[model samples]
Target: MDCHPRGRGRGRGGRGNRNEESRDVRLSKSLSYALRHGANKMGLQMNSDGFVFVEELLAHQQFRSFSLEDVERVVATNDKQRFKLCNHPEDGRLQIRANQGHSVKVTDLELRAVALDDPDYPREAVHGSYMKHWPSIRSQGISRMNRTHIHLAPGLPGEGGVISGMRQSCDLAVYIDVAKAMSDGIQFFWSENGVLLTPGDAAGMLAPCYFSQAQRLKPSPCEIELH
Candidate 1:
């Protein structure tokens, strides 16, 4: 899943002016793009864990106008908590990484493996998509595409403990049979932000057979039988 933070403006009584808020949003998007998908393309040296030195990142041309504090602000104030800042393993200097939703091959992330028998396993897992893509999805199954994993939400938006998985504007919700998929040897992992992720089969495709049901959530709510 290539999830990026929604650029949310500050509240009326929040810190910083409109200009600062705009800058923060711009910086957040740039960081999201680089850390999740383009660190290598951007020539930033990221470790296997997906961390890049804050200093090195600041030196990039796109961030010349930004500062370390700006990065900290973005991380601290992000509504979804998409980015993480921590000290480098080799040195005391600070580094940053995307929490999840990486297109890059990040080997190490704080993901908890969810077994079928896990007591806390989600009762429902859904992937949100649009009606326009339902035909292709129904035929080809859900593909991770360029992302490392296919992202699923444990529950819909506004539900308790649900955040950062599916988009709010999504009209279709494909419910996955998590227990059935796990019983069939498909691995499921829970990200730090509560997103359910799976690498799928060897080909990285979650076939329609694993989909328990599909529902049209917008304009109206109705069940769709997958053929």
Candidate 2:
């Protein structure tokens, strides 16, 4: 997977990813939570800061493969009000000025978030709820986000910002779904090149008995279907 890193993120012509050296650490964090805690169990809900709290507990890197771009797209669609934060959708295109400069072409921002559902990402809780369970998720792994308290970003609720937070700064909100890991898990691959499909839709959901029984979360992986 080209685990070798290129060092800290540098602002320039192009930065494909953030801290590449942190890949294994990040993936380990993600896998640890999904297997041990069942992040999906956390009843997913969007906070005003533009994050969806998946109380079940998740790893730091669950959404590693997922781009900040995905987060931006979801906010625009999931919460209609978020559009106010955007430049203005025209011809179904999300056009916005960037901090670096130049405009990035965002097509169907709504579909972006929807596509992330299947990236096998860790559940994300708000600041308060995440902070309350932060100890467990980071140390042992396990959280009940519904009952946990968290903090809000205090930033404008923009879907793009949400993504930029992760992919760029890799910071938007604090998530605590790191269920105590210590075990191997499953990996889903496409039948072909995987260019035609992704685990991003309802089908991407990875719900399981352990997720429900141990985590007490919902949206069983069974609810989703395979192509």
lDDT of each: 0.85, 0.25
| Structural RMSD, model 2 | 19.1
Worst 10 residues of 2 by lDDT: 189-198
Q: Model 2 reaches what TM-score against the true structure?
A: 0.17
TM-score of 1: 0.89
Tens-place lDDT per residue, model 1, 76-150, is: 787677888887555667888988889989988878999767898986699999989999999999999999999
Model 2, global lDDT: 0.25
Q: What lDDT score is found at residue 48 in candidate 1? A: 86
Residue pairs clashing in model 1 are none
Overall local distance difference test of candidate 1 = 0.85
